[model samples]
Target: MQNRLITCTLLLAALGGLSACNKNKGGKSDVTGWNYNDGKKSSGFYVAKPKDIKTGPGLVFVQGGTFTMGATQEDVMGDWNNVPRRVTINSFFIDKTEVANVHYREYLYWLENVFQDPQYEAVVKGAKPDTLVWRSELSYNEPLVEYYFRHPSYNYYPVVGVTWKQAYDFCIWRTDRVNEKELIDKGYQNQNVLKQELNGGGQDNFNTKSYLMGEYQGVPGKPKKNPLKDAQGRPRNTVKFEDGILLPDYRLPTEAEWEYAALGLINENPSPRRSEKQRGEELISNRQMYSWKNDGYDNLRATRKGNWQGAFLANFKRGNGDYMGTPGGLNDRSAYPADVNSFFPNGFGLYNMSGNVNEWVADVYRPTTNQDEDDLSPYRGNEFKTVDVSGGEGNLRDSLGRIKYVNENDSSLRNRFNYQRSYAVNFLDGDSLSSSSYGYGITTLISDKSRVIKGGSWNDMPYWLSPGTRRFLQEDQSSSTVGFRCAMTHYGAPEGAGSKHKTGNFFPTRRQKR
Candidate 1:
C-alpha cells in the first residue's frame, strides 16, 4: 500500500512538472508543441472577419434574377440574333452613369504625367479618341470635333469616340486608382508616398497586384490596430482578399448582364410575398420594349409624380432630321449626346441605359451565342491566363509596374474532365475535320475581334431603343456614338450577404412531419 501511494505521488509530481513546463512555454498547454484544440492546430492562419463591401465610386448595386434575354419587341431587322431565351444573371454592381469626358480626361492626365517617355507617350497618344469622328461632310461639325473632348460644357457628357480596347484600358487604370485610394484611406499607405511615386514615374506607380506581391514598395503609413497576431504576439499587417477590403476587377459587363440590368425586370417581378394572405406568383407581368416602364415608344415623358412628371425619361432621336426636336418645347432637350445624368434613371438607378450613347460589352459577337452559351451568366470571349512564374521566383512585374501574365499552358491546365486548351477565346468554333464548318471571317462579317455594342445613341431612331437589340463593331475601331460603363462581380450570396431571407425552420413544431 505504501509503495502504491509513493507511485501515485511520483506520477502527480511529474504531471505538475509538465504543467509548469507548458506554462513556461508561452502559457500554451499544447503537449505536442503544436498549438492545438479540438483536433485542429492553430497555425496562426487568420480567417478574416466578414466585411461589408461598400459600393465603389459611381456604381450602384444591381439585383439580378432569371429573365428572358432577347427581343421584347418584334425583330424589326429580322437578324434573329437575339432569340428569346431564359437565362439567369448573378447580382453585380455597375456604374450609375456612363464614363464622361471629365473621367476620361482624368485618365489622360494621369497617363501624361506618369508616362512621359517616348514609348509610353505614344501609348497615351494612341488612347486619345478620334476627335475627327464628329466631322461630317454634309454638315459643319468641325467645331464639335475640336471642342467635344476639351470643352468644360461637355465634361459631364458621356465620352465617345473611344475604342473598345481603350475603354478596357480605362477600366484597368480606374481599378488601380480606386484601389490605391482605398489603401490610402484605410491608412495602409501614405498619401504623400503616392504623390512622390507618381512624380518619380517609371515602375514606381501603385499597381494593386504589384503591391500585393511585394514588388512595389509604398511608404508605410499609420496602420489600423491589428485584429490578428503572430505566435510571438506580434501584430500582422497583411490584407487578404477574403477580408473584402479589396474589390473585384472592374470590367465591361457581359452582354447578358448589361441587357438584364437595362431591362430592370425586378420591378415587374416582385418578391413572393405580396400581402399577408396573398402570395405573388413568380411571373413577369409586362414585357418592356424600352428601358422605361411604359409599353409605348411615343410617350417619352415621365408619368411619375414630382416636377419631372412630364420630363423626358430618356435621350434619343425622335425622327429623321430630329435629334432633340425644336428649341422651344424640345422633346428630349439636347441636340447631340446630353450629359450622362440627363434623363431619368431606370429601376436599377442606372442612367442612360437605353439611350445617350451605345455602350460596348465584353462579349465577342456571335449570331448564335444565345443558343450556344451557358444559360447561367451567359458570356463569350474568355481567354484564360496565369501569372508568368518561369523566372524561378514568381510575381515579377514589368517595366510599367504591372504584373505580367502568359497564356495558361495546356499541360498545366489539363484535367480529368477534358478541358485541354491553351486559350478559349474561340473554343468549339471549329473542329479539326473541317475549316468551313464554323467560318468566321470567310463567310460572315463576324470575327473573334467583333465585340457587341448595346443601347441606342442620340443619332439613332426609336427602333434602336430596345435593350435586347444588339449591334457589333470591330474592337479596334472607335465611333462618335459609342461609350461604356464598368461592372464588378458580386462575391457572396446571390441576393447579397446582408439579405434577410427566411432562415431557421420552414415549418412549426406541430406542422413538422415524421
Candidate 2:
C-alpha cells in the first residue's frame, strides 16, 4: 500500500509540471475569439442591448387599438353611414390644435423671405389666400375680409383659406426648421448646411444619436469623442435612433388615427385582448362632443354641464340668422381672435378637436373604408419622390413584363402604379380587389379633388360635430371652412417614466371587454 501511494503522488506532480510548461503540439491557441496578453483578455464582456428607448418632448404617443371608426349610435334618421368595423391602429402623434392664422402666416412669411427666386415666388403667390370667404351674402363680413388674417388680434384663431398642398408644404417647412434649430443648439457650426440648397446635400450631417450620446455638443465645431473605444481602439459614434430624435416629416393625421383620438378611448382594463372577460369597472368610457360638455348658447341638448353664461368654446355664429354675435358683444365672426390656450381641453388633453376650424387628414374620401384597410397605421395614400431620370435609372419592371417608356416625360414614368382613378384603391396591390395594375388613383383625377378634411368648423351645424365624418378637397383648393393640424408618430409605450402628467389619473383608464 505504501509503494502504490508513492507512485500516485509522482504521477500527480508530473501532470502539474506539464500544465506549467508550454506544450505546443498543434501550435493553435485555445482561445478562438479572445487573446490574452500582458494580463488582460482582448475581448470585452458581453452586454445585453438596451430594450426601451428614452423619449424627449415633441412626440405625443397615441395609444392605438380596435374601435368602431364611424358613428356607432345613430343621432339622425336614415343614417346608416359609418358602420362600426373592428380595426386596430398603431400608435402615432398629432398636433393638439388646428393650425391657427398666426402659425400659417409664419409659414408664409418664411416662404416669401427665403425662396425669392422667381419660379418658386410665382407658385407661392398663386397659393395665397382666397379672401372672398369673409364676404357674407346677407350681412357684413367685410371687416373680416380686411382684418381676419393680418390683424394681430385674430392671430390665435384657426387659419382659414389655406390650400391642402400649402398645408403639406407648411409641415415640410416646420420639420426643416425644427431640425435646423436642433442642430444649431447642439453646437454644429455649419450654417451653410442649414441654408437653402437647391438639392438635398449636407443635410445628412445631422444625426440624432451622436448628439444624444454626448458626441455632438451644441457649440459649433466641438463634437466630443465617445469614451468607449471600438475593436481597433478608436472611438465610434453610437447608432442613430438610440437617442429620441424624430426626423421632422410631421404630417396630418390619418383618418383612422383622427377618429380614434377623437373618441379618446384608452386601455382602462389591464386585460390584453378585448375578447378577454372583463369586470364592470374595466370598461372604457365615452367622450363628449364639445371641448367642454353642454353649455347654454350653442348647446344642442337640453341639459348643460358646461361653464356659466354659455360663452363660446370656439368662434361661431350663435342663434338663428345670427352669423355675427349680438351687437357690441363680438359678432359671430367677432372677438378678433382668442388666445390658443383659452379653451377647455378634451379628455386626451387635446383642445378644439371639435368647434375649431376643420383639419385636413391624409385619407382619400371613401364611404366603405372600414370594410377594407389594415388596422395598423390606417392610411390610404402615398406619393413619394419621383424617380430622378438624370441619374443612372434602374430598369423599371411590372409583373407582366419590363416597362420601358419612350421618353422621361411619359406619364407612365412619372407615376409608378397604373391603378384606376376611382377612390376604390384603398388597400395595397394584393390586399384589395381594386388593385392598381396601371396607374395611381390620383393620377387620373381632375377638378377640386384629393386630400381629406376633418373636425367640425365654427361655421358648421351640429350634425358635422362627430369626429368620424370625413370630407375631402383638392390639394390646391383653399376654403374659409378649412384649416389644418400637424402630427408626429410616437416610438414606444405612451406611459413611461418621462410622462409629466399623471396620465392614469387625469384620463380614464380602458379595459378589454368580454
Question: What are the C-alpha RMSDs, in order, of all predicted structures?
Answer: 11.1, 15.8
Model 1 segments more than 4 A misplaced: 1-42, 270-281, 295-299, 303-311, 416-418, 430-442, 499-514
Model 2 misplaced stretches (Cα beyond 4 Å): 1-59, 72-81, 136-139, 189-220, 224-248, 266-282, 287-319, 323-339, 383-448, 494-514
Residue-wise lDDT of candidate 2 within 239-282, one digit each (tens)?
A: 22322233535777788888777665653334433222332243
The lDDT, on a scale of 0 to 1, for candidate 2 is 0.52
User: Could you tell me the TM-score of candidate 2?
Assistant: 0.64
Per-residue CA lDDT of model 1 for 101-180, tens digit only, reads: 99999998888778777767777798898998998889998999999999999999999999999999898888889988
Give each model's whole-structure lDDT: 0.76, 0.52
Worst 10 residues of 1 by lDDT: 497-506
